[model samples]
Target chain A: MRIGVVHETAAGERRVALIPQEVDGLRKAGHEVLVETGAGVAAGFPDAAYAERGAVIASATDVLGAEVVLFVRAPGSDPTLADALLAWLRPGQVTVGLADPLGAPAAAAALATAGITSFALDLLPRITRAQAMDVLSSQATLAGYKAALLAASRLNKIFPMLTTAAGTLPPARALVIGAGVAGLQAIATCKRLGAVVSAYDVRPAAREQAESVGATFVDLGLDAADAETTGGYAAALGEDFYRRQREALGKVVAASDIVITTAQVQGVRAPILVTAEMVHAMAPGSVVVDLAAAQGGNCELSEPDTEVDVDGVTLLAPTNLPATVPAHASRLYAKNLTNFLKLLIVDGAVRLDLDDPIIADTLVTHDGEVVAPRVRERLGLA
Target chain B: MRIGVVHETAAGERRVALIPQEVDGLRKAGHEVLVETGAGVAAGFPDAAYAERGAVIASATDVLGAEVVLFVRAPGSDPTLADALLAWLRPGQVTVGLADPLGAPAAAAALATAGITSFALDLLPRITRAQAMDVLSSQATLAGYKAALLAASRLNKIFPMLTTAAGTLPPARALVIGAGVAGLQAIATCKRLGAVVSAYDVRPAAREQAESVGATFVDLGLDAADAETTGGYAAALGEDFYRRQREALGKVVAASDIVITTAQVQGVRAPILVTAEMVHAMAPGSVVVDLAAAQGGNCELSEPDTEVDVDGVTLLAPTNLPATVPAHASRLYAKNLTNFLKLLIVDGAVRLDLDDPIIADTLVTHDGEVVAPRVRERLGLA
Candidate 1:
C-alpha cells in the first residue's frame, strides 16, 4: 500500500495529515509513503525530517497520485479545495480525513459522483474501540487547552492567587460551560493556572467528569434528563430551556474573570449560552473565549475568528484554534488517522469491512454512493 | 494631608496610582482623598466606586492642586507629560510614584528647580522595612507572570504532558534566564503550567530562589564574587564575561521550547545572554520572551514592546507587562504607595524625615535640590 500526504490548502489550516513519525509507522508496516513538499512545514515538521524517516518528499501531483491519500482536513472541508482536488481525484482512489461529512453533505455527494471512496473521520463512532481514532476528541483537547491559555493571556489580571508583601492577590474566578472534552480540558487548565474554576453542563452525567477535573459543577436546577444525544454530545435544547439556562448562568458569568464556553451540538448551530446582556454585566477586564465559534458561537456577541470588546469585556471567538497549535494538533490528528488506517488496511491492502462499525460509520462515500446514513440523511439522499 | 490620585499620562500605561480600596484606606486614616475623574477607569474602577469609598471626584486641575499627588508613572517617566505637568506643579507640592529618576536624571533636576519635592519609588532601598513599599518587586512579579502566560499562549504546543490514546505528549522544556523576582515568578508560572522549567542566573544565590519555585538551576561555571551589587541586583558584567556566558548558554537555549530572559542590571543595559545564533538553533516552534527588552533586551533579536519572528521562533519583548494587567497592577502599586505614604505623612502633615533611609533614598528632589546622591551623581550635579 502506498500512502500520500498533501499540504493543507484551506486558509489557516496548518495541520498535516501524517507527520514523519506516523510515516515511519506506515513504512515499517511494509508501506510506501510520499509527502508533498513542505506539507508539514507549518506544523513544525520539515521535509528533511520526513525524508529521514524513509518517506519520499514528492511534488503535490506526485504525492496525490499515490493509492491512498490522507489529510488533516479532506478537500470537502473547504469547497474551493474540494473542486481543485476533485479534478485530480481518480475513481477507486481512497481518501480519508475529516471532510465535515454532516456539515457539508453535498461534498460527500460530489465524492460519490466522482467514484471516490472517502472516509470522513468526523463520523467516527464514539465507542471505546474507536476512541483512538476520534479526531474530534483529540482536537477538542487542544482547543480547550488553548482556550484557557487565550483567556488568561487576554485578561487584564493574573489567574493565580499571590501572597506577596504588597498583599494577598486573590485568584481569578473562571467558569467553563459544557463539560465535554474541550470544556473539561479548559477547566483543568484554568485550575492548573491556579484559577478557581466552576463548570456547567446540561447533561447531569457530566457532573462527575467535571468534578474529577477539579471544577465545582454548578447545578442550574434545570431538568436535562434528555440533554445528551446517543453520540454522547449535548443535544440542542429548545429556546425556552436555553433562555432559562442563560438567566441562571448570567450571575455566574458576571462574577467570573474568565469564561470559556464550549457548548457545541454536533451538526447544528451551537446554542447561545452566553448572551450579550450577560457579557455586558461582566466586570471590566473580564475575558470570554467561545470554543463553539465555528458553529456560530456559544456567546451571542462572538464573531467567528474575531475578538470583540463589549463594555470592557473581551470576547474572543477563534474558529480554528487547532491551527494555532498546529504542531501538537497535527501530531495527535496523524496518530488518530494511523490508528484508523489499521482497520481500513488489511494485510497491507485496502479492504473495507462494513461489519465493523468503526469502518462502516466513517465510510462517508463508498462505491459511487453516499454510504454513511447520517450524511445521506443530511443531504436528503435517503 | 490631601492625597490626590491622577490618571497615568504615559502612553500604554493603564494602571492607576490608586484604586477605590486604597482610597478607602486614606479616608479611614483621616486624610482627604481627591481623585481626577476617570483616573481609575482604565484600571476597572469607576468614578462611582471611588466616590463610594469617600473619595471626591474632581477635575485634573483640582486633583493636581492637592498637597500630595500620586501617579503610576510620574511626569518624569514621560518627557511630554513631564513638560505639561511641570507647568501646573507648584513649589512645596509633594509628588510620588515611579518617576524613573535614574533613567531620566534631568527630570529630577527639573523637579528640584521647581521645588516640587518629588519621591521616585524606583529608588527604594532593598531593606526589610521598605518591603511593602517596593514598587519594583510588585511590578516585576506581574511582569514575570505575564511573560510565562504569553510564552505558553504563543507556543505551538501544550505545556503539560498527556498520555492520551493519540500517544504521550512530553512536557515543553522552558529555560528562564536571571532568577530575580521577575525570573523566579516566570519559573513558578511555567512550572504551574506543567512545563519542565530550568533557570540560569549569574548570581549563585539565585539558585536557591529558582529551586524554591520548582526550577532546576543551571550552573554555567562562571566565577564572579562581585556579581551582585549592594542593592542585591545583578551587577554590570563586561563584554568579555557576557560573550563567555552567551557561549555557555547556547546549548540550553537551543534545547528549550520556551526561553524567558529577565536578566537586567540597575542603571545599565541588560546583558545579551541569548544570541541570534543560539535562537536560530532552537526548534521551529520555540518561543523566547525578553522581560529585559525595555533595558535593551537579554536576547539579541528582541525589540522592546514588539513581537518578532525569527526562523519560526517567536520573540516577544513586552516593555510594560504590568500595564497590560492593570487592575491588579494598580492594586499592588497603590498598596506600595500607601505603605510609603505612612512614612511621608506624619501627624496629618508632609514631614520629610531625612534620617529615615526609606524616606531619604526614594526622595529624588527636595527643597529645590536633587538631594538623592545617586540622582545627583547620574545628573553630574556633584
Candidate 2:
C-alpha cells in the first residue's frame, strides 16, 4: 500500500496529518509513504526528516496516485485544492482528513462522483478502542490549557501570592464560571500561579470535582436535578433558573480580581453570566476573560477576539488560544492524525470494514456516494 | 435604618434585588423597606406584592433616599440613574447591588464623592458565611443545566434509551469534556435524560467525581500527579503531557454521538478538541455542542451562536443559554442577593468590618477609593 501526505491549505493551520515519525511507523508496517515537499515545514518537521524516516518525497500529483491520500485540512477546506485533488482522485481510492461535510456537502458528493472513498477523520467515534484516534479530545486539552495562559498574560495582577520583604502580597483571586475542560484548567493554572481560585458549576456533582482541584466550590443551592439530559450535557433550564443564577453569581464575580467565564450551552447562545451590572460590581481594574466571547460572551461587555475596558476592569475575549501556541498544538494534532491513520491501514492495504464500528462510523462516502445517513439528509440525497 | 430597592436599568435584566418575600425578611429584621415600582416585574413580583408585604413602593428617585439602597442592577449600571440618585444619597449612606464596578469604576468613585459608602453585591466573597451570598455559583449551576437542555433540544436523537415494540433504542452516548460546574451539570443532565454519559478532566481527582455522577470517567494515561494546584484546580500540564493526552483522548471523542465540550481554562480561549479533521471522522448526523464556542469553540467547525453541519455532524455554539431561560435564573439570583444582604445588614446597620475574610475580600471599593490591591494594579494605580 502507498500513502500520500499533503500540505494543509487551511488558513492558519500549521499541522500535518502524518509527521516524520509516523511515516516511519507506516514504513515499519510494510507500507510505502510519500510526502509532498514542505508538508511538515510549518509544524517544525522538515521534509528531510520525512526522507530520513523512509518516506519518498513527491509532488501533489505524484502523491495522489497512491492507494490512500492523507491531509490535515483536505478538499472542502480549500476550493482550489479540492478542485485539483478531485481531478487526481481515481476510482476506489481512499481520501482521509477533516472534510467540512456540513459546510460543504457538495465536496463529499464530488468525491463520490470521482469514485473515491472518503473518510472524514472529524467524525471518529468517542470510544475506548478508538481513544488514540480521537482528534477532538486531543486538541481540546490544548485549548483549555492555552486559555488559562492567555488570561494570565493579560491579567492585571499576578496570579500567585508572594510574601515579599516589603509586605506579604495577597494571592490574586480568580473565579471560573464554567467547569468544563477550559474552566478546570483555568482554575488549575490560576492556582498554580498562586491565585486563590474558586469555581461554580450547575451540576451538584461538580462540587466534589471543584474541591478536588483545591478550589472552593461555590454552590448556589438551586435545585437543578431536572436540568440534565440523558446524553450527559446541560439541558437548557427555564428562564427563571438563569435569572436566579445571574443574581446569585453577580456577588462572587464582583469580588474576584480575575474572572474567567466558560459557560456555553450546545446549540444555544452562551449564557450571559457577567452582565454589565455585574461587571460594574467588580472593583476597578478587575479583569475578565470571556472564553464564550465568540458566541457573544458570558459577560455583557465582552467583544469577540477583542479587549474592552469597562469602567476600570479589562475584559479579554481571545479568539484562538490554541493557535497562539501553534507549534505545540500542531505537534499534538499531528500525532492524533497519525494514530487515526494506523487504525485504517492494515498490512499495507486500506481496509473498509463496515463491520468495524470505527471504520463504519467514520466512513462518510463510500462507493462514490454520500453513504452516511446524516450527510445524505443534509445533502438531500436519498 | 431604611432600605430601598431600585429597578434595574441594564438592558434585558429583569431581576430585582428583593422579592416581596425578601422584603418581609427585611421588615422582620426591623428595617423599613422601600422598592421602586415595577422593580420586580421581570421576576414576576409586582409592586402590589411588595405593598402587601408591608413595603412602600416609590419611584427610583425616592428609593435612593433610604439609608441603604438595595438594587438588582443599579448605580454603576446606569449613568443616568447614578446621576439622578446623586442628590438623594446622603453622607454615610450605603448602596448595595450588582454594580458594574468593573465596567463603571468611575461610578463607584462617584459614590464616594457623594459621601456614600457603596457595597457592590457582585463583590461578595466566597466564604462559609458568604456561601449563600455567592451569586456566581448559583447562576452558573442554572447555566450549566440550561446548556444541557439546549443541546438536547437541538440534537436529532433522543437522549434516553427506550425498549419499544420496534426495538430498543440504545441510550445516547454523551461525552462531556471538562469536569467543572457546567460540565458536571451537563453530565448529570445527560444521565437524567437516560444517556450513557462519560466525562474527562485533567485533574486526577475528578475521576471519582465522574463516577459519583454516574458517568464513566475517561482517563488518558498520563503522569498527572502534578495536575493539581494548591488552589484546588487542575493545573495546566506541559506540552509533552498535552501531546500524550491528545493521542489518548482521540479514541473517546470518536465514539460519542453527542459530544459536549465544556473544557475552558480561565481567561483563555476554549481549547479546540474537535478539529475539522476530527469532525469529519465522526459518523454523519452526530452533534457537537461546543460550550466553549464563544471562546472560539472546542469543535473545529463550530461558529459561535451558529449551527454548522460538518459532514453529518451538527456543531452548535449558542452563547447565552441562561438568557434563553431568564425566569428561573433571576429567581435564584435574587435569593442569593437577598442572602448576602442579610449578612451585611446586622441589626439595621451596614457593617464594613475588614476583619471578616468574606467582607474584607469583597470590599473592592469604599469611601471613594479603590481598595482592592489587585484592582488597583489593573487600574494602573499601583
Candidate 3:
C-alpha cells in the first residue's frame, strides 16, 4: 500500500497526519509512504526527518496519486476546498481523516459522488478496542493541557502557594466544568500546578472520573440520572435544568480565580455553562478559558479564538488549541492514525470489512454511496 | 507617621507599593494612610477596598504631601520623572522603595540635592535579620515563576510526559541558568509542570540550592572559585571564563526544549549564558526566556521586553515580569515594605539611625548628602 500525506493548507492548522516515527513503522510493515514537500515542517518534523525514515518526498499532486491519502483535516471539512479536493480524487482511491461527518454530512455526499471510499476518523466508535484510534480523545488531551497553560499565563497571580520570608501567598482556585476527557485533563493539569481544583459534570458517573483526576467534584443538587446516553456521552438536558445549574454554579464561578469550561456535546452546539453575568460576578484578575469556543462556546462571553477583557477579567476562547502544541498533538494523532491503519489495509491493499465495528462505524462513504447510517440520516438521504 | 502611596508612573509597571491588606495593618499601627486614587487599581485593589481598610483616597499631590511617600518604582528610577517628583518633595520629606541606586547612581545624587531622606530598597543588605525586608528576593521569586510559565506557554509542546492509549509522549526538557532566587523558582515551576529540569550556576554552592528545588545541576567544567562575592551574590567573571562557559553550555542548551536564564551581576550587565548560535542549535519550537532582560539579558539574542524568533526557536526577554503578575507581586512587595517600615519609623515618627545596619545599608541619601558608600563611589562624589 502506498500511503500519501499532504501539507495542511488551513490557516493556523499545524498538525501533520503522519509523523516520521509513524512513517518509519509503516515502512517497516512494507508500505511505501509518500509525503508532500514540507508536510510536517510546521509540526517540527522537517522534510529531512521524514526522508531519513525512508519516506519519499514528493509534490502534492504526485503524493495524491497514491492508493490511500491521509490528512490532518480532510478537505471536505471545508466546503470551499471540497470541490477542488474532489476534482483531484480518482475512483477507488481511499481517503482517511476527520471530515466532520456528523456536523457536515454534505461532505460525505460529495465524497460519495466522487466515488471515493472515505473513512471519517471523527466517527470512530467509543469501544475500548478502538480507543487507540480515537483522534478526538488524543487531540482533546492536548487542548485540555493547553487550556490550563493558557489560563495560567493570562492569570494575574501564580497558581501555587508560597511561604516566603515576606509572607504566605495562597494557591489559586480553579473550577473545571465538565468531567469528560478534556475536562479531566484540565483538572489534572490545574492540580499539578498546585491550584485548589474542583469539577462539575451533568453525568453522575463522571464524579469518580473527576475525583480520580484530583478534583473535588461539586454536586449542584440537580437530578441528572438521564443526562448520559448509552454511548457514554452527555445528552442535552431541559432549559430549566440548565438555568438552575447556572444559578447554582454562579457562586462557584465568582470565587474561582480560573475557570475552564469544556462542556461540549458531540455534533451539536456546546452548552453555555458560564453566563456573562457569572463572568461579571467573578473577581477582578480572574481568567476564563472556554475550550468549547469553536462549538458555540460553553461561556456566554466567549468569541472563538479571541481574548476579551471585561472589567479586569480575562476571557480567552482559543479554537484548535492542539495546533498551538503541534509537536505532541501531531505525534499522538499520528499514533492514532497508525493504529487505525492496521485494521484499514491488509496485505498491501485496501480491505473493507464491514463486520469489524471499527471499520463499520468509521466508514462514511463507500461504493458511490453514503454508507454510515448516522451520516446518511444527517444528510437527510432516503 | 503619615505614609503615602502613589500609583507607579513608569511604563509597564503595574505594581503598587502598598495594598489594602498592608494599609489596614499600617492604619492599626497609629499611622494615617493616604493613597493616590487608582494607585492599587491595576494591582486589583480598588479605591473602595482601600477605603474599607481605613485608607484615605486622595490626589497624587495630596498623597505626596505626607511625611513619607512609598512607591513600587521610585520616580528617581525614571530620569524624565525625577525632576518633577523632586520638585514636589520638601527638604525633610522621606522616600521609600526601589530607586535603582546602584544602576543609576545619579538618582541618588539627585535625591541628595533635593535634601530628601531616600531609602533605596534595591540596596537592602543580604542578611538573616533583614530577610523580611528584602524586596529583590521577593520580586525575583515572581519573575522566576512567571519566566517558567511564560516558557511553558510559548513552547510548541506540552511539558508533561503522558502514557496514553495513543502512545507515550515524553516530557519536555528545561534548563535554568543561574541558581539564584529567580532561577530556583523557575526550576520549581518547570518541575511542577512535569518537565525534566536542570540548572547551571557559576557558584558551586548553588548546586545544593538547585537540587533542593528538584533540578539536576549542570556543570560546565569552568573554574569559578571567585564567582561568589562576600555579599552572597554572583560576581562578574573574566571574559575568558565566560567564553569557555558558553562553549561548554552550547550542547546542553541545544538539548533543552525550554531554557530560562536568570543570571545577573549587581550594578553591571547580566552575563550572557546562552549564545545566539546555541539557540540556533536548539530544536525547532524550543523557547528561551531571559529573566535578566532588564539588566541586559542572559541570552545573547535577547532584547528587553521583546519576543524574538531565531529560525523556529523563540527567545522571549520579558522585562518586569512581576508587573505581569501584579496582584501577588504588590502583596509580597507590600509585606516587605511593612517589615522595613518597622525599622524606619520609631514611635510614630521618621527615625534615621545610622547605627542600625538595615537602615545604614539601604539609605542611599540623607541630610543633603549621598550617604551610601557604593552610590557615592558610583557617582564619583568626594
Q: Each candidate's TM vs. the true structure?
A: 0.98, 0.47, 0.97
- Tens digits of per-residue lDDT for model 1, B168-235: 89999999999999999999999999999999998989999999999999989988778999989789
Interface RMSD of candidate number 1? 0.8
Q: lDDT value for candidate 3?
A: 0.90
Ranking by TM-score: 1, 3, 2
Q: What DockQ do the predictions score, one after another?
A: 0.84, 0.02, 0.83
Q: How does model 3 score on DockQ?
A: 0.83
DockQ category of candidate 1: high
Worst 10 residues of 1 chain B by lDDT: B75-84
C-alpha RMSD between model 3 and the true structure: 1.6
Q: Which predicted model would earn the best TM-score? A: 1
Write one digit per residue (lDDT tens) for candidate 3, span A6-35.
888877889999999888789878999999
